[model samples]
Target: MDRTTDTTALPLIPRAALFGNPRRAGAQISPDGGTIAFLAPRNGVMNLFVAPRGRIDAARPLTDERRRGIPGYAWAHDGRHLLVVKDNDGDENFHLHAVDRETGAMRDLTPHGPIQASIVKLSPRHPGEAVVSHNARDPQWPDLYRIEIATGRSTMIAENPGLAGFDVDEDFALRLAARLEGDGSQTVLRPDGAGGWAPFMRFAPEDAMTSGVLGLFTADGRATLMLSSAGRDTAALFRLDLETGEATMLAEDARADIGEIIVRLHENTPLAYGVNYERNRYVALDPAIQPDLDALDAAGIGDWGIQSRSEDDRFWIVGAASDTAPGVAWLYDRKTRALEKLYDTRPDLADAPLAPMRPVVIAARDGLSLVSYLTLPADGGSAPRPLVLLVHGGPWARDSFGFNPYHQWLANRGYAVLSVNFRASTGFGKAFLNAGDREWGRAMDDDLLDAVDWAIGQGIADPSRIAIMGGSYGGYATLAAMTRNPERYACGVDIVGPSNLETLLATIPPYWEAGRSIFTRALGDPATPEGAALLRERSPVHQAARLARPLLISQGANDPRVKQAESDQMVAALKAKGIAVTYVLFPDEGHGFARPENSIAFNAITEHFLAAHLGGRAEALAAEEIGRSTAQLLEGAEILP
Candidate 1:
């Protein structure tokens, strides 16, 4: 294994090749195992393409969506219709659409206006029905409804009873619900059989996000697979008996928590559970699936992403991807033990010089382990090169090793890329996650700073030339880095980052009402005097006058989570303080840039901005590029080359 960083000159991979939409993606097998459906462009917009199983060339467009392509769709139990989720102008108010495969007719099941919806349970027992959660009645919390796919009729099954979220069993029975206490703790409830709810489990504020029910057992609906770090250092998987409240450990990882579980859809039993340390590794619980896992491991195609399998379990659709390679979809014949390639997401990158991502564990200032991934450039000598501290959003999310175009773009432009999993990041343990509580701008920002110091200490990053960039919570981190430690970074890029904690909490979308306790726990409640004072102290908008470095901020005008007002006030504050800042706004985007043209346009400007401040290579943006995008230059136009 070559851990040495590449320093030789290589061909420049085009920005379009890296950032452009894939030719085809999200290929899946229908439930009945007779047909296959994938997402491909139709009249330049992404739409569903259906074909017979095992035949990729014969795929045809099933749905014709003109404005924004269908982002995701799933096969219904009957195999007669496809359940599709879509949003308008990136507002993220998802609507459930059922497309009749034979007639290609689409019906909006939940036609309610501007509300978030998600598929809760799709049971094989009820072929014509699905349990979905919609935030129609209340803007903040989602209420459960049983929707009939055939007639588009919806009936309220169990209205959300002020819990943050709910989990259902295979029988579509409400098994678990989590309620956030005022003290930042979480109480898990189960049906008491007397038509009321009984407390099943409880989690302290520090263990709130770390411990929760994964799902109820499909076998009996009386047992649940849960993750808890109550008396441990890391969150581990356990099977809990609903009747006795006794838990038995199923799996435990010293360094990481259980990331995902692969369950047998029909039986509702977990087949394998995955632990994501540096990369993802799966543990097979059922011996029958071990041979398939062995076959996949022997193939060495790349990290496997199993998409779907036939109802009879004969054929499987999987995707293989790596940090350097885009992704190659495959179809595996389980009976024959054969693997066939479907399509390479980006064949242009087949022979391109993409940087390799290396996982390293660094220590924070407080000696806590900080898991991180780093990518270095492939051009010439490396004498402490300029570094791009790429922070992931989801103050709750952790960065993993994968095919990241942003990392490749930065590395190709002659900058070292480092993504750190700060204290509050998930997949670690309750202790690490709790460390981030009420320490958003304090300890969370410290972990990033410590990462920079470690990078410089290892001679992989130049101490004098480093830039911080991220989106969502990452975007908030970018602003915090610039305002809190102005002399540390040469520049910063924040995409859709909340500027004011107080305003951000105040304006959170209604559907997030259930999770308000988590928010109040992480960042103090702005409604209270102490919480309000803390939020004000951590808000970047109030500290904008302290910025001494150039900053590039991007936002989707229709972002529902972090409203456009966040960027507006941040930019206004920077302008009032006479600070140099570049702001880009996309009218048709939400949270992040989704459309290809907007993504390319933003990257074009971002490249130029990074180059101007950090002396990195930047692809020149042509006039035609800007003409094709809907991006508006809010301010700092001079930063564009």
Candidate 2:
């Protein structure tokens, strides 16, 4: 196959390239008001990137030569250092590092290997001090640690003897370590500073659970606990005593499920806080600060990180994002009530014609309602077109209505895309999540089919042409749907999805060893002799013969979580069966594609396969003329291809 040398003439553009290669995706401004950093894939590795204060482009590597490579990054309070974390590979051990921002020097703070260190809070006021949770002392209860950025040493502030989370007081002292009971109601632990921890005060756990703690508020040099809770099962705003533990309800934030609360410190009064609803819009704190934030957003501020407590309380650093705007730095002047768009991550996508996602609902089987977020094509077309069921990675993780890149691409392809939040999805509460615990290939699979049914009933989906695609759990479902109900789906695209359940359960990396406890409850009997047999019953590998449809499977060789052996063994098994199957292995990636080159290559094949099967417009691969050459590479497989 002669590959296309005209990179500019390719039928489809790489989503990763078009998305501007966000290395540390979701980069935000630090509270200290000095530096900026983001997550990005540098040199084919996902690491934290630091852009120093007053200089966005001068950003450098915050972490040193990491062994496993820095998989994730977070800012410390002083903004002088960064906390580089490693977990995506499966071993959840987060070796804490105090990275010197100015010089790019890094040292392991937690030297403790294999111990999962989780950062709960990084002081915006005190740069050196940090609040992190680690299982250093005990495994069941992860005690909180206060670390000094400069010294590279840590002080155990609160031993949560139980399952608890820490919330800092105004003095920046460890005051409230909220202890969660398995049932409900939290025991608020306060420090006696006598080398002991006790309940500084008490509030109804029922209230705390319902209202949802807003935050730890400081005024008049004292601390108060802000509650976004009520007596019921929803979240609202309420204020409580840090010491006395007294409680008072603020304005009933009826929206409940407090999106994210950002508190602004004012003079002995309520600090300006931005309370977001459902990760969508925000309620400008105290009505007075609304205009400030609105003006900032209008000015294209991508990030809003309040720094210091000034008397005017108006000067704040603002970051921004838009349909077309990537992450950017902005300056919001409260005095002038003006916002200045300071920086841009990528200027190329400025006129890319991005669209906001619209939230919609499609009913599932059994009359149960299903929720989804849809992004329509910029170039409008009629209904009854080939659509894609873009299943999210986590079958348990709910898909929110937002601007997802996958959804955007499918929408642009003149297809109505459906993202289903199936049963057992989180955020809907324990019952919903628990509902999916044991129903992996059964009800969970049913939910995917029900979504297709819903789409067809609404005349929004093409009856004869449909594709099922997802990553991780989504990938598993894609194969399962094609295997169990071959006639329903025309093609299946599985990206790092498990083919066999028994292998997936036993083969997960060491970092996920402890996760077996959760896995057992969901899948059943991880250790028992009969357990393997039970998992095989649900595995797509065991049911491969049932699929008479075209299939494409991609696996990352270094995928610690899923492992390459999974795809290798299954694809090999299918080929032996004289079934046609396409298998692509990426040596650089792990559970998912972390590099742009792999993502572009993998997505190109998926696009071509979908177009050929679903009769959508064909797109030629640019970098690799081997896309079809690659598809031709899998021509003789035994399984369906």
Candidate 3:
């Protein structure tokens, strides 16, 4: 358990610079390529802004969103407006809005109260119209509606018949639908030509998440694109013949699923596809775009993605970033083979001593190959520094090699940061994902322990000064690690994580009823006695008495998936045992902290807590920092510096 290190100093990166809103991000080109739009901070809140193409200096804000910033936006096909989606304080009841570029007027396209609405399809054929989905009729199922973007008039095109989701063509025609069965399997259905739906394909429960219809790819409505892992180890891209029921394989990887597909705008024709293992490997499906991909690869600026393209595909807004650098947006001219840098997402980090993330494969005790990323302090000599195990949420999601802010911030604070893609993480093959079924606190926790052993064995971490931190499932993992093996970690941070599986299952949002079976099957069903007992046994709340290290818990008041009760129950149990656990709550937040101020405030408390226990350097919390956020310290304020 060596803790000695050569303390070659590195500048402490400010929490604001690392966690604050980006200078400019989500850049996209207008349909005619006459203007560029991106999300930038307007009065400390991210708002939609647009500028004439190549004239970022002339940018003007189109929307004045003061509270929770706009999450994402896209240019309308008509080129007259921009489409944006917003939710209230991370409640996730998203509402679609259209911003008129000329008048600077924002109109809520779907103003239904407390309903989750999203744009389903926007077509150039119907330039002023968009197909949207909302659960106004029934909270459990969202119905489809065609809406006039300018006037916000709507017409119900199709009603949900207990379908999970629907797919539409560029012509604004609903062609395919997917239904999640009670057994956790998925069935793809097609229109029967007489107002009824006929089953097109069926997938087992294991392939439910990996397999689905992507979109109708054929102009004749006879074929569609799909990603399916049935009869294969990994999910692969395929063109499915709707009439013949045959699938033509397009691209695939043995190690990873097809994660991204680049297609021609409005045409549904795929140009390239990408699969991610340790890093992303993009393959050009159409040879015409090979040169563009080649040029981007040759640029040596990390992984690049085509963010937006002109109508004629002559101009592309490309975003590139790596593990050590913040993202840079570039305007790529396809005709001239030139890449002009637009702006850095975070100019403050351009000169920061950010650590490089190295992807490593660790063997679980059961011999499962766990893909993990490690980032050590830039100038802290290789003498086994204190380590932080940062787990990703989703337990269904994964930790890929990228410019992760948490990694940089923690590394700058003088701790080695490691993120592990343990069992149940997506993007890997189905066998690896299905292997984690109902293994929440048992096998899943073991994989983390094995990763710790590997880090310590490699002289990368001091065995005694390790901490676990994460949100959602990662938060659950942090709590599980602290309680199951209290001797391993020095401290733990849990953000919006569920403590009791039974309560978590019972409190899921009504809109998530479609996928409830998937959760029950993957994490044990609470309705059955045997399953309920298993859930109770695996829940960290049941093992709270075993906790022996410092713990920090943060929660959003309105988390629909993992409700606030989960955190409240765990804190109550710990307090009942006279254990001192720090609790921070954001009344405005839901699943996680969406506001940068709230994030910074929580991290401010977290760093001090870690510093006290793990001997890591921390930036002292400023009074103004917490004043700007809605974070309420409900407990353990004494731990703050």
Give the winner by TM-score.
Answer: 3
All candidates' TM-scores? 0.96, 0.76, 0.98
How do the residues 421-516 of candidate 2 rate in per-residue lDDT, one tens digit apiece?
776654443334556766788888898888788778877787788889999998888888888898998888888898887878767754343334
| Candidate 1 Cα lDDT to native | 0.87
Overall lDDT per candidate, in order of appearance: 0.87, 0.62, 0.90
> Which segments of candidate 2 are over 4 A away from where they belong?
1-11, 23-72, 86-93, 113-115, 124-126, 135-144, 155-256, 265-279, 296-319, 322-329, 353-356, 428-437, 499-538, 558-560, 563-577, 622-641
Q: Best by lDDT, which number?
A: 3
lDDT over C-alpha atoms for residue 187 of model 2: 59
State the TM-score for model 2: 0.76
Better of 1 and 2 by lDDT: 1
TM-score: model 1 vs. ground truth: 0.96
Backbone clashes in each candidate structure, one number apiece? 5, 37, 0
User: lDDT of model 3 at residue 606?
Assistant: 94
Q: Against the hidden true structure, what lDDT does model 2 obtain?
A: 0.62
What would the per-residue lDDT of candidate 1 be over residues 342-456, giving only the tens digit for each residue?
8888887888888899999999989999999999886646688889999999899999998999999889888899999999998887788888989988899999999999999
